[model samples]
Target: MEELIKRVEELEKNTQKSSRERELLLNRICELEDLVEDLTLQLKKSKKTIRTPVAPKESLAINNASKKTNAQEDEPWLFYCPKNKPYEEILRNLDFSEGYEITSSALVSEEALWTQILEKMNEEEIPKKLTALRKLVSVQLSSACHHELLIIVRGIPGNENPLFQLILPHIATLAEYVNIAWSEVENSNPELLGRIALVLECEQDLKVLSVDRGDTRLSLYVEKLL
Candidate 1:
């Protein structure tokens, strides 16, 4: 009887030990799995960081290139009349580096010459000349003409004859001539029609008999005896 009891107790102890060993092995396996998952995540993050590190110099270069491109695109070239000798001389005399305003008389003379030149520009040269003149003169002439013509029309007290009267007839003829030239200009380049419109708008009082862009036209603005 005593031997049987001892044998049973030994058997129980052995079974408990085996169960404890199995539990310990499962806990160790779980810990190892957790460690592998953590290592894999760390490795992926390290590879990503190595592959595409941000470069300060490269970023600065890209920014500078973009700024340079923008500046080039925005900048417009200065323009001048190649045909008018006086205008050419005036432009040559101008010290653009000094940044000075051109004399009113000089600007007026240039405007008059440009008005005359516009009449002579044929189909082939109209586009080039108009583009050039827009950059040089058209941008400045509107306000200048208004102020100058007003001053001339309302002469100073000392002047015997108003300056406008002397030029009025010539101005009338020029207006008619401009109307004809603008028609040709419109036919050649419709884009420049706005410039003609601007001139007409600036000198609104000047009579424009007709702007016949399609065919033959005439201006009654010129003084006539009927």
Candidate 2:
């Protein structure tokens, strides 16, 4: 009976040892699972970090250029008639750069001239086909038949008010252009022709230009004649 009791006690110890061994094995498996999960997360992060390929410098430049092109396309008007507005004093000013043009060729009334401009805008596919009147200051309209006070005009694109782009800082340059153009309207004397401006004042948000003489300051205004 004593031996049997001793045997029973040994069996209990063996069973306890087996239970501990099983617990250890289960704990080890949980640890391995956790390690694998962590490694998988780290791997996913590394993949994300390297996912985006570095663009080449040339490619970046091209993309930027394309963006600029799109922007310019949306706005068909060209920049700084600065090159030509100065053309007034210089008689050779007739030599217009590419993409610039004299809106009216024949002697047309002011109202007619405006109509011609709109017609031109409608005819031309802006941006792709850039076209606008060349900045002509000294426009000669006096003729032998009837010098019925023929004249021309000049002004800034947008100064205090912007026609399209932000007002530029080059006021002096604009002034020079205005003075030359307005001079054609008048002489050293004050101009009878009223200064003009382009504005978005009304619901139409009309566009026009203005010129100041003496100082030759230039600015934009609104003309709702359209």
Candidate 3:
């Protein structure tokens, strides 16, 4: 009877020990699960933080470039009469060069030049848009009795002014661009529609060169583009 009692006590102690061990193991498993959840949450937060700045930073560049390339697409130059920009327009206002302004035919804008360049090309591709930009033939006509038109068409490096990015490298190819300028001038001024006289700018003086189309034609002795 004593031996049976001892066996019972031993069995009870072993069962208690096993129960404590199981409880400890369960606690450990719960701790591991909590750690895994915390780690997963941290990983998600980290991904969000990384994407916030990186994505917009890349997209901003493309957005700016597209805006610049396609700026004032609905307006094209008819005729800008200014031979030189005003002091306030030129002097330290480099911003004036990039942020071009345009106004409708009812009136002109602060930056009236861009209005004459591009007019409605939302469907054009980038290269075609640039081609349209390069094809600008600047012709300035005076309203006086003397019908003299100044043609200022040249392709400058894109850095100086984004607008006048011309491509006339050789002197021989000048007449083609001149014809383009002539057409623009004719359309703008109805008086010079029939014909005009060429008062060529020679040195500091004006020299008259005759070209007949019914009236007088004025040709400027164009200087070497600096």
Candidate 4:
């Protein structure tokens, strides 16, 4: 009976030892699973960081495209004119540097000349004749006529002369080449002042009327009358 009881105790001890070993193995598996899950989360975070650089590059490309579009839109429209010879041809024909000065006295003479013409037409009695001068200007846009127009402007006190204001735009339209001596005329008269104001107002409607003030270079530019 003692020997049988001892054998039963030994079997119980062996069974208890097997249960403890199985429990330990399960705990180890659970810990390993937790470690694998942590590594997977870290790997996902790394991939996200790597993708971050691509977003800024795309943003930069969009900005550049927008800037180019704005630049194109901001460009100004060119003046419309009838077809004429190239600008270079005009440039080759004129000499701006010499004989450009119109003395104040000469300018006075020009003003007097217009005064006489206006008086002869009885401009006060017929104000519409003054209006007709604008039409006459359009009819005579030739080089000789352009010279006469310039002479008319040179003498008139642009600020004082209503006639100058009326005629200055037509003059600008016909000016193929222009050279003004600042020494001879620097805001000297109201008529010149009026002409300058007209130039600014009509800039959009006129071609680039380059002015060479106080310089000695004569270049031809074509002024087309439409």
User: What is residue 66's positional error in candidate 2, in angstroms?
Assistant: 62
Give the higher-lDDT candidate: 1 or 3.
Answer: 1
TM-score of every candidate: 0.22, 0.22, 0.22, 0.21
- Top model number, lDDT: 1
- True lDDT of residue 20, candidate 2: 69
Q: In order, what lDDT does every prediction score? A: 0.33, 0.32, 0.31, 0.32
Tens digit per residue, CA lDDT, model 1, 61-140: 11101111112332111122222224223333432111112221222333454544433332122222322443333323
Q: What is the lDDT of candidate 4?
A: 0.32
TM-score, candidate number 4: 0.21
| Candidate 3 local lDDT, residue 93 | 29
Looking at model 4, residue 11 earns an lDDT score of: 96
Give lDDT tens digits, candidate 3, residues 1-226: 9999999999999987975675465556556766898999998888745444332222111111111101223211112223234434421222221222222221222122222323321211112222222332222222211232222322222324333222212111233233445455445653443221111111222121222223333232322211
- In candidate 1, stretches whose alpha carbon ends up further than 4 angstroms from where it belongs are 49-226
Q: Which RMSD values do the candidates have, in order? A: 38.4, 35.1, 33.1, 41.7
Count clashing residue pairs in model 2: 11
Per-structure clash totals for the candidates: 0, 11, 15, 13
